[model samples]
Target: MKEAQKIFSRPRSLRNISTHYCGGCGHGIAHRLVAEIVDELGIRERVIAVAPVGCAVIAYDYWDFDCSEAAHGRALAVATGIKRVRPQNIVFTYQGDGDLAAIGTSETIHAANRGENVTVIFINNAIYGMTGGQMAPTTLLGQRTATTPAGRQIGVHGAPLKISEMLALLPAVKYIERVSLHSPQEVLKAKSAIKRAFQSQIDNLGFSMVEVLSACPTYWDMPPKKALDWIRDVMSKEFPLGRIK
Candidate 1:
């Protein structure tokens, strides 16, 4: 019998502990990808992640590196300060749709506009996962949520905000890519995009962000498999993937 090769293992930058994300939630996968990228780049010691106040509020618990908890919707601001004070550190912010596109809109825009030397990991699950299933700024039009039980209406709720596209228009932004976690191939692409985002910051290139179209099965009220399917079939249509800038 041939010995089994160790094909996969946990990333050194990731702590050996279970995450609090709900089943089918994409946060875990995103966390692992970040950890893997940090390890690959050999920057775990110098990396500093700013955790958001949404579903990933306790992200510090998973990453085996320096992390800071920011006020709700202030992750970018916090990351900006850290990166400025410690110019040599690899700084990044992990934020959700509500935190990034809604309450933190100003911070997001200003940071990118200023060309802050920091990476941003924006998780767009379409709805507010941490605080009930409210309609997030990235929530697809006509999508049902706790606040929009009858489905989101254009005239009343307005159209979904294309934040990534808006950010790409800024001259200071060096890179911006929208990726999804619905399929294996896309996951690989997401990892690549994330790595590039980090690399851009490392090279002292202006602001870089990778918008990940993650899934929220519990909030979506769908099975894990169905939730992933929705991200591919339904969500991707609204927020198409690729290098936006």
Candidate 2:
């Protein structure tokens, strides 16, 4: 029998740790994608990952690159400080919907407005994951969650927050795109978009964002497969995964 060639299938700059996210949670996929990108781009040593509160807050624990923890909803601020002080280092903020589109709205907007040379991986899972399933700003109308048990009512909850569209209008933004991780193909696209965001920053292009429409099966109270269906058939209608503006 011929000896098989040794194949390196894992990332060189990655750490092994049991993730805290529940089964079918999209954080793992996105995290792996980010790690793969960092390794492939050979920037792990010079990259700074800013982890924010929410489900991905402990992300620093799994990444081998230099990482810093940001207060709840202040990832953009932390990333800005790091990128500005050390422009040579690639800075990226990993944030969830609750942290990015809600409480950190001002920080996000201002960072883009200032053309901050940093990458932001904004994960939009619709409902808040860490602190139970609250209706997040990106929560789709008529979607049922813990807080909006009777389904989100447009009259009371108002319209869903269209963040990417809002941000694209700003002149400071260099690259803006939205992608989903609901399937294998889309996940690849998401990784590509994310890689582009980091590359944009590396090229001194300011304010690049790749918003990922991720799934939260536990919070959605659905099976893993059904959760994906919801994202594909229902959520996509509202959020429309693509490069907006």
Candidate 3:
């Protein structure tokens, strides 16, 4: 019998350990994508990640590279400062919807507007996963969340924020893509988008962001497989997936 070749292995940029995110959570996949990009670019040693308050706040524990914990909604600002001082290094911010689209809106917009040489990995799972499944800024309209037991009413909760489009309007932003991980094909596309976002910064092109439509199974109260289906069938309707810029 012929020996089978190993098809895959964990990227060296990721620590050889399990993550804390709940089963079916997309943060783990996002982390692996970032690690794979860092490894592929051979910049693991020079990569600095800014992890903000959210589900990924403990990302430093998973990634092998240096990481700084930033306050909620301050990831972009912190990454901006880090990239400015360490121009030789690659700086990226890993932020969730609540942290990025809500509290960090100003920081994120200004950073992209300023054309900061940084990469932003925005995970838009719609509802905030870490803090009791609250309705986040990106939470879809008419979608039920912990805070919106009756489903999100536009009149009361307002329309869902389209952050990627808003950021693409900034002149300094060189790249903006919205991808999802609801299926194998989408995951591949998401990985490609992430690589391009990192490459843009490496080339000093300007601010780049790849908004990933991730799944929050626990909060969504669905199994891992069902959550993915929801992302494809329902969630994607509100936040369409594509390259915004």
Candidate 4:
């Protein structure tokens, strides 16, 4: 008999086409994890993803399922509508720091507050990767960005928003977890958190979200490996990992 396959190939829920994400960017990993969960749960056919306006706005091109585009910071609103009308569908929204935490904070908070039965895959890369490395709500203190050339200052930029923790206080939010992709161990943990988030939806639980601390190497002006190290050494301090609920 042929030797057992060492490892499985890419999930069928993900297309074979190349992505436009930068080298070492965590969006690809996030996409693969979501696709893997969808495939494993046999929900690829029922999955409906809301692709918001950001770095992942074109995510529909990579995922092999029904996907719709939402205006800037409006992904949660659109997803709420879709899930409300098609309660049977597995609805999820993929959003980045700028799109979700900055412009879409109100929608996200309200959705969780209402306990919407949908999953949200939040990519928190600290800086806005798509829009010229500008400062985002999640950008760490002292973090440099195109908009914060002198480094983030509390007097002007205010404090970085701990969105996961803020959302965890909502009564309707059934589950909330913050994870990172800095190392292999962290990646595994992140995947596990993502799986649980999806399972929460499958069980018809209230709002569930998995905030992934992703890296933006190209925008951060560092090599991919160094960017991962920064996430582990510096970024995690501002946004600690683990379940909020």
Candidate topping TM-score: 1
* lDDT of candidate 3 over 70-127, digit per residue (tens): 9999999999889888899999999999999999999988988999999999999999
What is the Cα-based lDDT of residue 189 in candidate 1?
Answer: 99
TM-score of each: 0.98, 0.97, 0.98, 0.98
Give the Å shift of residue 166 in candidate 1.
0.3
* Clashing residue pairs, backbone N/CA/C < 3 A, model 4: none
How many residue pairs clash (N, CA or C atoms closer than 3 angstroms) in each of the candidate models, in the order given? 0, 0, 0, 0
Where in model 2 is the C-alpha error above 4 Å?
A: 5-8
Comparison by lDDT, 2 against 3, better one: 3
lDDT of each: 0.95, 0.91, 0.93, 0.93
Residues 182-225 of candidate 4: C-alpha lDDT, one tens digit per residue: 99899889999999998999899989999999999987889999
lDDT of 4: 0.93
lDDT for each residue of candidate 2 in 32-58, tens digit (9 for 90 to 100): 999999998999889999998999989
List model 1 lDDT by residue over 28-85, tens digit each. 9999999999999999889999999999999999999999999989999999999899
Q: Write down the worst ten-residue block by lDDT for model 1.
A: 135-144
Q: What is the Cα-based lDDT of residue 45 in candidate 3?
A: 88
After TM-score superposition, the amount by which residue 131's alpha carbon in candidate 1 deviates from its true location, in angstroms, is 0.9
Q: Give candidate 2's TM-score.
A: 0.97
